[model samples]
Target: MLTNIFIIAITAEAMSGALAAGRRNMDLFGVALISFITALGGGTVRDMLLGNYPVTWTQHPLYIYLTIGAGLATILLARFIHRLNQIFLVLDSMGLIAFTIIGCNVALKLGYDTPVVIMSGMTTGIFGGILRDIMCNRTPQVLRHELYASVSLVVAVVYLTLMSLGVSHGVNTWGTFFFGLLLRLSAIRWKLSLPVFSYSPGRWGD
Candidate 1:
């Protein structure tokens, strides 16, 4: 079940990345590059941070093939993609939540404590999007959009708490996945967001 979600999440992430590249009028290579990063960059970054060596995708090259195929498919389907914007958001939310779960599981396996586990999940959930935005020369949506990182944090916290309370691994994973997905979708539907704080100095107060 988790494996299925992982596959779906990466495919969705890759397609979304291709769409981002398409919006920029990028070429095929650029689309593929962004798609790859958006699908796997988060896990790569997390592994690097923990010095886990040889990253997940490096060992599992089929994941690369899958993401690249998804990216190319997005190009072929670009004409109809706009019609599915809401569907796109739903899939993206799934990917976000799944990525968070994967990150938390990795940190737990590495014997990290709660703080690091939470941070690991957030990093894995958002950093790929962050890297995608940087490469595309735009502000990362996770940094500014509704409840993005907050969703990851919430998922990780609740997941860890449940684990501490002796919830079965399968049950905890499934329960938290739905809970996080609901929170994210609600945030999108209601336009929930963290309050923006903009600060500027008026020429050092003149």
Candidate 2:
């Protein structure tokens, strides 16, 4: 369930971003490249780290086709998509939830320790957006302020702890996803930021 939602949300975000790029007069190749990267970059990294060769989309070619179809559809309907930011925000939120769940799940399946699983989850949830930001010439939020990656890490640890205590997979997955999603949405809506790290001049020199 979480994995499927990740795929769907990513496809939508990729399609929208591709359409936005195209509207700037980019060529088809450029649009496709952006869409493909946005859709699959993080999952690819996660699979690679897990030694899951021939990743999910590669095994299921339809994932590629589905993203392509979404891209084409977005291009056709871009004019109709008022308030594109709203669409992106909702999809992005869903993607965060889904990706974080699947990441921790995969790590757990691989027989990793809980700490490693939590880190894996954080990587899966944030890396693709970091890639997208670099490609689009923006600062990746994962490397910036707020509780973004920290939230993902915390949820993963909590989810893994629950599972270790014999919680059902479904409950553990959905519960963590919702908790992280709601927390992130609230952070965004309220402009809630993580406390900034401050250092004394002497400490900095040391």
Candidate 3:
């Protein structure tokens, strides 16, 4: 079940990445590259950190083909996608929550400590989008946006707490998914955000 959702999440992310590439006036190759990164970069980073050889996408070549195909599909659908920003936001949030849970599970199985598990979840949730943004020459949204990474953190924390309380895997997964999705939707609807820190440039002697 989670694997199926993961596939859906990656497809959505691939399309989102394609949109970003198009906005940058990138070629077809660039679109495909960005789509691949946005779909799998986070999991790649997580696997590398955990020393898990053969990252997820490589082990499952279907993921690679699917993501690239999604990007190309996005290029064909670009004319209609701009109006579907809200839909994509929901899909992206789903991906964030799903990836975080999956990453946390991987770390837990490896006997990692709590902090590592949390960080694993977050890294898996956000790094793909961060990489895509970097490649597109833009600031990463998770670093400066409304409750993006926070949503991942919330999901991880909730899942961990549930696990420690001896919650069954099925309950924990569904519960955390709904909780995280609601939090993300609320953030978007209400424009919820952490306070930004901006600094004014000053003369050295001032």
Candidate 4:
């Protein structure tokens, strides 16, 4: 079940990265590169932080192939895809939740504490998009607006709570996934965002 969800998450993220590359008028190589990074960057970072040697993609070469295939498919179906913005948004939200759950599980299995588990979830959910945005020279959505990382944090908390209460693994996983997805979709639908902080300079000698 986790494997299935992970595959979906990676594919969705890859497609999003491919679309970003396409929007920038990048070549196929650029599209593939961005897709690969966006799909695996978060997991890679998480593994590195945890010292889970070899990284995920290196351990599962098929993941790399899947991302590359997604990139190529996005390029081939660019026009049709562009017309389906809402669909992509839905997929992206699912991917975010899926990644968060996967990250939490990974940390839990590794005997990490709750705080680390929560941070791991957020890192897995958002860093891939961050890398993709940086590579594309666009402001990351997490930094600019939306309840992106917040949603992931919420998922981690819910998952942890459920586990502590002795909830079944299947229930915990799906419940967290659905709740997070709903929160993310609602945020998108209502343009929900965290309050922005702005810095202003005062008079030097005032």
Candidate 5:
């Protein structure tokens, strides 16, 4: 269930990013690169960190094909993709929630402790976007005041706690997904932000 949800979310994100690349008038190779990174970059980082051999894409060769197909599809569908900003935001939020849960679950299955799991989950959710943004010449959104990575962190801890308390796997899975999703949506809807530096000059320099 989670797997399928993540697959769809990844597809959406890849397609959205591909469309963005196309809108920027990038070439075919550039479009494909952006789509592939947006889709598989997070899972690739998670697997490498966990020392999972063969990586997710290599293990599931179909993922590569699907990513390419999705990219091409996005190129064809670009004309109708008028709401670029909204699509990117929605797909990114979904991708963050799905990848975070998957990361936490993978860590738990591998017998890692809670702190490790939480960090892994956060990284799994955000690093892909970091990479993509760098490639696309934009600041990474997770690094901003926007409660982005924080959402992944809080939900990961919630998932870990629930699992530790003997909650059913099914319950923990969906609960974390919605928790992360709500955190992101609330942040977006309310324009909520983490406290920023007040820029007291002497505080840092003196």
Candidate 6:
């Protein structure tokens, strides 16, 4: 079940990356490159930080093929895909939640504490998009808009709470997944965002 969700999450991330590449008028190679990074960057970072060698895609080459294939498919269906913006947003939201859950689980299995688990979840959920945005020279949506990383933190907390209450793995997983997704989608629909931080240079000087 987790494997299936991970696959879906990576596929959605790849497509989103490809769409961003297209919007930037990138070539096929660029599209594939961004897609790979967007799909694997977070997991790669998590594994490296946890000292889990060999990394995920290195162990499972099929994930690489899947992300590249999704990117190519997005290129072929770019026009049709452009018409499904809302659907893609929902998919992206699901992907974010799925990544958060997977990351939290990985950290928990490694005997990490609550704060570390939440940080791991947030890293896995947002780092990929951050890398993609940097590569594309745009402000990351996670950093600028909506409650993206906050949603990931919420997923981690909810999962941990559920587990403490003796909830079954399946229920805990799906419950966190849907709750995070709904919260993220609601934020998107309602233009909700965290308060922005700013520094007034003149005031600081004064």
Model 6 C-alpha RMSD to native? 1.7
Candidate 4 wrong stretches, greater than 4 Å:
200-206
lDDT of each: 0.92, 0.75, 0.93, 0.89, 0.82, 0.89
**Can you write out model 5's per-residue Cα lDDT over 52-137, one digit (the tens) per residue?**
66787898888888887898798877777775667667777888888898888788888888888997898788887787787888
Top-scoring candidate (lDDT): 3
Summarize candidate 3's per-residue lDDT along 93-132 as a digit string, tens digits: 8899999999999899889999999999999999999999
Candidate 3 TM-score versus the reference: 0.96
What is the alpha-carbon lDDT for the whole of candidate 5?
0.82
Those runs of model 3 whose alpha carbons end farther than 4 Å from true positions after fitting are 203-206
Report the error of model 2 at residue 89, Å: 1.5
Q: What is the lDDT of residue 113 in candidate 1?
A: 85
TM-score of each: 0.95, 0.84, 0.96, 0.93, 0.88, 0.92
**Cα deviation in Å at residue 111, candidate 3?**
1.3
Name the candidate that leads on TM-score. 3
Better of 2 and 4 by TM-score: 4
Question: TM-score of model 4 relative to the true fold?
Answer: 0.93
Over 1-206, each residue of candidate 2 has an lDDT whose tens digit, in order, gives 76678777878767855765575566776677767776777778888988877786798887787776677677777777676777677677778777877887788778888777877787778877777667777677666755577777777777878887999978887788788888878777887777767779998787
Q: Please give the TM-score that candidate 1 achieves against the real structure.
A: 0.95
lDDT of 6 by residue, 16-128 (tens): 99988988999999999999999999999998898767787898999999999999899888878768889888888988888988889888888988888888888888899
Query: Clashes in model 3: which pairs?
Result: none
Which ten contiguous residues of candidate 2 have the minimum total lDDT? 16-25
- Model 6: number of clashes? 0
Model 6 residue 101 distance off true place after TM-score fit, in angstroms: 0.7
